[model samples]
Target: MQTVASESGSTLRNYASILLLLGGICLGSLVGFIFGNKVEGVKFIGDIFLNLLFTAIIPLVFFTIASSIANLQKTERLGKLFGIVAGVFLLTVLISAAVMAGVMLLFPIDQGNTLRTIAAQALIDNPASAHQALTPSAGASLTQVLTVNDFFELMARKNMLALILISLLVGFATLRAGEKGKAFAQFLDSANEVMKQLLAMIMKIAPLGLGAYFAYQVGVFGPQLLGVYVHPLALYYATCAAYFVIFFSLYAYFAAGRLGLSIFWKNNLTPALTAIGTCSSIATIPANLLAAEKMQIPDYVRNIVIPLGAPIHKDGSSMSSIIKLALLFAMFGKDFSAPEMLLAIMGITVIVSVVEGGIPNGGYIGEVFAITAFGFPMEQALPVAMVIGTLVDPIATLLNANGDLVSAMMVTRIVEGKDWLSSRLNK
Candidate 1:
């Protein structure tokens, strides 16, 4: 019998996934062409996928954040690591935001009225609904709904942010609560375990959700949209690509041992592939852990960095979100100043990276919160969410996963008191 550990299954599945994706795109387009002007099945598919993405968000966030935070409390050397991580986090935001803004300025997706028409079609198909808890009074403008206060108010109404905040509070409080919090912690612990098991089942359904988007994309836009949107999409994709390439290149070039491109690719392929399949850095933790070991990240750094990076170090996703948001604003002829876009990215980083810890489904849940945050109507939100959820995920998760490998190198270098930077200067 073939060993269960054989990589043959993985290699075959990777190719199979690519084939299915391409075929689905073709099939969805043919359906769209046949169905004509009245076709709205894409919207139905969008909704189903959106629901699938968000179904376990609240519970998953509550459990994982609580557990992860509780564990972090045991660390004493975190002060310096925290600072380093924050610096990396901020640099990531700045780089991503700048690249996105630069691309927006250069390409300027304002194809006169055609772009707006696309935006309108996307909106009609994915209309927003009240979260059942916090619908504003009649006739609130999208602008009014988009203000910072409204964002926070949504949190108060138990939206994703609210859930993240609650998880942090409960988790931190539990840590401080000590023996007094034991019973409560036990309850949460049990709840968290059960939810994760339930979550495994939810993940099995992701491809279904993902498939819907692929089906609709093929059915609606076919390969044609790729040509039309290629200009804008290329800019966005390049921005994401730039992040992993430039950052890792700089890190490796300066490292004393010289981190070769081949080694980097070899060590990271599994995590990247896993991220593509799972659409989540958080979900790909096991693969990421394995990749770290393969890359020779010390156990300590591997242990801490991967978990931390998964939640707050969304270098890929944050940048991609910024690009998408800029595109959305561009579609409406809204001219947000460069600095304002940068600021918005900063705010988004805080919201996405800090507040969204232990989210149940990293890709789906994060994308939902983001679609809503970026002020797309629920109609526009669904397809946009689906496309981005699929498109950005593999790369984003790969970047986030790779953060551990790099951080391990950096941290181990730090532990050894080696000045890799100084040596580069000497050379």
Candidate 2:
């Protein structure tokens, strides 16, 4: 009975911690909104937190990945693992793009009018600059606009696809190499272990981080920010919901009817709330772990897939990205042919999702990438992404939190002698 009581107490504490953090954010945002620039002080603290998160991300990726790949066996299982990951990844991207395409059909951003409105505005308060170069040479033919060169250049700049390619190649090569490679891999393993511990230490600072982040956001934009981006944000959020409902609904229905839905909801609700409130997966991991335990999922599944999936299989991010690129095309009066959209979808799915891990989850990485790639004013994209992405965060958390379960279920079924793919598909 003490064991049961202890478990209950721990669960309560976990849930309470999440609530406390969220309450702090809301109160801070309210205070900042009312006071405006007065909260600039808090924003300064948030800036430091952002720097710390960004600092941790790059090393975390290189070390963890190097260590993971280094330990891969010479067995054929490595090939199978990559194949499955690649297949699922492509499927996730396709699903998200399809959802976005449908959303576009329903609520197409009127490009000409949006551009006209932007042009008429007295201020280009935060115009992106790199997109300026990519803007089709004023009347460049569709053929040129959708050229192999532009796509290739985008990749060369580590624009999403390029980074994924680099990371995958490096990881796989390290795995396939002999003794020296294994030695390097071991170094990376120790590095990843150290980073995780460092992250735990970092969490001690999160109350201040959350306070500062919200203060800056509220101070700079106030409530008007939400109103300004409401429409696009709404569309983004809806697409995210569509993906969650379509994909997970089917998975649950096929998995165990009401029981499956209950299972997913029970484990997912808190994480989903944290994702919505915090708007950062990195900030929500502790809650996700708490929710996972209640589901009684195997430790192997949680240990492997949760940490990995938080950064990978980011269907929500993919959808927002496609929309962001489409919006950028609109912002600059550039056109998007079918091929460009398709390429953008594929590139974001396969490349952006992978490298996005190394980029700070809620930091300036997206803005930096945009500034570097599109030569756009760095101010706009990250803020824009965050604004647009708010629509998707809750659903993204749902997808992400449950993607771990999906990986677990699929793997468990595979080991249990069931044909996971065929069986689930038929159901």
Worst 10 residues of 2 by lDDT: 114-123
Off by over 4 Å in 1: 1-6, 12-26, 41-49, 52-55, 111-114, 121-159, 193-229, 253-303, 336-338, 353-361, 413-427
Best by TM-score: 1
Q: Cα lDDT of all candidates, in order?
A: 0.58, 0.55
Predicted candidate 2 versus true structure: per-residue lDDT over 88-111, tens digit per residue: 545665666667766765676656
**Candidate 2 local lDDT, residue 83:** 57
Best candidate (score: lDDT) = 1
Residue range 150-249, candidate 1, lDDT tens digits:
4344332225545566678778988898888878887887887887777666655445544555455545554454443456567766766776788776
Worst 10 residues of 1 by lDDT: 129-138
Model 2 error, position 2 (Å) = 10
TM-score of each: 0.72, 0.60
| Model 1 steric clash total | 8
